[model samples]
Target: MPRSAREPGRATVQVTNHRLARLPDVQSQEVAPRTTPGSGPVVDVEQAEAALVEHYPRLVRLAYLVLPPGLGRTRRVLTAHALVQRALPRRRASASVIPAQAAGGTDGGGEDPGYSLLRLQVLRTALEAGRPPKRTAWPRRSQLPPLFPQVWGLKLFPRSGGAEELALDQQLSALSGPARAAYVLRGLERLPEDHVRKVLSAAGVTRPTAALREASRVPRQDALLESPEFDPCSLQARPTDLMRRRQHTKAALAAAGAAVVCGVLLAVPSGGWGPDGAAAPGYAQNPAARAALDPAKVTKVPPTAWRTSARTDFSVWPARGGLTGDTALLRRALAVWSRPGGSVQVSATPGTPSGAPAGPPQLLYAGRVDAARVVIFYDGLRLARYAEPARGTDGAALDFARVDAATGAEAEAVVLGRADGNVRYLTAPWVTKAAERDLLEPSAEAVDLGLQDGVTAPLAGPAEATGSCSSWNVLQLTEGSGIRLLTDLGELTPAHLTVGRPGAPGEASEPEALRTWSPFACSLAAVRSQGVRSVNAWEFARQTLPDGSGSAAWVCTRADTWRGDGPRVLAQFQTPGGRYGAVAAKAEGVTACGTKDPHVLAGVLWKSAEGRWYLLAAGSSDTGSIRATGGVTGSADGNLLAVRAAQGAQAGLKGTLEDGRTISGLR
Candidate 1:
């Protein structure tokens, strides 16, 4: 075959060796410069060849690291050497030109002779020989491993297929000389535009316009060359086919035998019942019985009731009854009832009946009396006596009379003295007989009155003077309105109380009754019973006065409790603004009838004012229930109650408050 003419205006180099000739025309041009001796500068062809050989191994190693491993090692080494040999003469010529320029600066020498052209040649050889390999067209499908089922999977070819691929090449051929070279350099060798320009410049291929035009004409091959660096061995090792086959087989088996398996299991007895324990009485025959015995149908059994308590002495009493006992005794008994730590003492004095004898031998009262006050004594120490009605024997002075106990007679006599020597009597003139009658005897009735000055007086009567007295005064006042009493004692008391008239002195007082009293309030709403699985709603009302303005009316209901785990009592009070204030309580010392110290979950409090609701308090009770279980769980708001249902199992109850707030786990 006649050799094709080298492209016009493109650099060409003739090669002497048959091996070199058989290679591409570009390769021949690359290698020809090194072989041509003395054409431009005396070239040491042997030295260039030796240098290429010497650096070949390192070039191959570099290529291996950067290029795909599919390129065989031997081919890489050979290609490196060939490339180096081709590049040597071009670099040497450029290096020699530097000295030539310097010599020309001095005297315009015809050619630079001092430069070691051979050394330059060797360096250039090394560089060209180490250059990366040019990209090739898509390899044959047979060359690919079976693991790469898709030919385009390697991404080494344009996705446009063969027809479009030919069209792209034709477009490149119509470009000008420099453009064609630029296109060829960039497309074939995959060099960047700047790098191609640099390489061509170094090789004395200086035609800027042509190179740029050629670069512009080159079709973008990045789309074709961007292949996944896949390893054939890795793909071959995957179990894709096996996995698909197994999945298909599993699906087929399931579809084929599903009805048969279900039918067989359904027909067989579950072995769950009967007198002899051979089979269930109704097993598969009765639908309900079957369902009950079905293993897969099992579900959690929620707790029927929750009971809990703490070690508190306070007890809220129901509203129906009045307390019985010595008032003082009752107060003392109940005072320390809710206190965790307390003590009590009683003592009596042994003394003379009348008064203590003024002597050294007198004994003191028995027992300790610290922090105690004397409340009562049985003896009297003062007396009062009245004048007798009788005339005296002397005429001038009306006789002062005295009554004699023995005769029961009124006799005229001189008044010896008044009892305690403090009595004084005066006679008044009577204008009429009716006045004398009135003067003779004053009315024996006494008015029951309170001191308007706010000074308190001691009350009479044994109960008032002696036992069961509260620390605070318990007043029973009978006035025009009705009989009413005020005391600082409670249990099941009202949640809120209001007093004072509007626009009056110290008017309008609304105090939270439960908190102000000794014993806290308790409510029956949502009260849990043993083995009951439902929650109940109870409602109650409390009367209250409006604020200081006194123009509005207030009515309150039982809100909710603050404790999450314990029994919670809640009451709601309505304000003039149509909003409600709620109060809640967690009775610490309460439990179910049979159980001891069952954990009572805390309750959450919610208050609504002016249509907006807010959480106020979180109440809690310590029920000793979790002691048996290993773990403990609690909520942030203190309302969610947690308990171990069984070994390693937990259960919780939640309660809802107003405004979408909720308290849980009352058990």
Candidate 2:
């Protein structure tokens, strides 16, 4: 492959300072045969630098292949440069062997003996920097993938969102550190077993082959990058081919990048539906009808398309066994999947519970359909025990991307409510300044639950009866407040929430009293049925559905299929004075526990008093969503309640297309 050269950065130490005559190995190489005029003897510093510059890009490629590959190219190249730097000083000191290819400035593998030493030092440094106990820069990308456009919400590709590489990186990241390193050095670098042993030994690993074996076991499902063999020389692919693919994908990525980036709340105004379920005043193609045309297409989902899922994924690291983890996971799901038209309170702090075995599982739900739709991100799952204050603004703040994923390292506090031992939902506050800026920024901090937050009054389907005529608490996340508000129905008094009710209290009405009067629905039994052993905490919420029907979305843990035991995730909306019916019901041999029901209404897809029409929505699970028992449609009609968040985008903004339909977006 024709590769572009990365410009070299100058080192402060001048090349003339290197004592070439004192070192035995470098003396044999073809240096200028003369040292600097004043300096006694040293390797030709300028000449040695050229070699590093020539190989820098390739070395970076190698580094990316080996190191935990989540960081973007910039960080990845720097990491590779770290390895080269380790060998640079030695080469200048005359202690390094000349690269077999250095004479010709080409990769003539196995001819250079010094390569082993250089790789050894680099691998050792990588292992040390990559390991724990110190807040080194090595693990940053793994904990949090560079939050740049390189990897955003799953826009992997219609040629736009090429999630294949991301999926591959995630799979590689899944391996243990030792295993990952072993595979890199032995597999990618083509180092001998003994050399690999030395690297692994320096890394403090007891079993070298076992680590490679473990890493080699990385699952290959949707990921396209194939596993490296023990010897890379035997591999047949060219780098140019891969680069060409990326180059091509880049063009498509730019053009098709129309789907608003993650956390950027956008909307598709509701229009009257045709008998074919198309929008009344539609475009060339009713974008909503694409759901029916191709069940897999999720880009620019139409206002009428509703897809909700109760993904029952593996829960190895959940709290109270699984409640705390599941609760936080559900919160994230609500935040990412149901946004653009709904409310979600995300208070996630990964850690081990008081009596739990370890910490929560490391979850990375990067989907094939929507690389941007990261429903769950449990990267900092490596938190230790809770040594910090349970309730306070005093302890070290939890960063989702930088925390360790291992257990027993630095313990994380599981802030469960005393009322029912259930996980508490906290809110983060922020301003919706712009789509790329504040809208995509993470929630600032976590808040604690309040007392009245648990009170419940299920809402009906009528427009007037949705959130009002009921008493409930909202987990409020705001830039100013760290806790949610547990308030009565009339108590949800934000500017937009209280628009109809003029006498309600709001941010202007009172100071930050989100915790006051917030009821505590700490009881897991509130949603648990007979046969399930445990259920995560839940809340009764009021929301509007895609059909513009008012309803509630039940956010809870996975349910039991055999006994239909766990908390119901969706409930049906009824007219005023009637209990909301159950829209999605668990049935034995019928309801597939692996998939989520997309039609389950949880969040609002569109809301427009400007036109007096609103469409509700729910999160669609990427995992096998079409296997619904009732033909994959309307399974979760009214189960979820989509509440408008108290924080972010103080008001909704809009524009109009030539068609009768309207377009909505975050301001």
lDDT of 1 at 491: 12
Model 1: lDDT equals 0.25
Candidate lDDT values, in order: 0.25, 0.29
Writing each residue's lDDT as its tens digit, candidate 2 over 1-667 gives: 0000111221000011001111011111011112222332233445445545654444444444565544443444445555556445423433123222323233424444344334444555555445554475445332333333242222221111246655656666777667777665554555555656655775468888788678668653321322331111122321335666787888878766654453133333243221211112222134433232231221221212211322111122221222223333233222222121112222222122211112123332211111111222232322212111223212211212113322210111122111221223111112111011011112323223232212111221111111121222222332222222221111111101110111232331122221211111211122222222111112223444333433333332222212232323322222212222222222222222223322221222222222222222222222111111111112232222222322111222222223333322110
On residues 346-435, what C-alpha lDDT tens digit does candidate 1 reach at each position? 111111122121111100011111211111111111011111112221111111111112110000011111222111111001100100
Per-candidate TM vs. native? 0.15, 0.22
| Alpha-carbon RMSD of each model | 48.9, 31.8
Leading candidate by lDDT = 2
Name the best candidate (by TM-score). Answer: 2
Report residue 388 deviation for candidate 2 (angstroms).
50
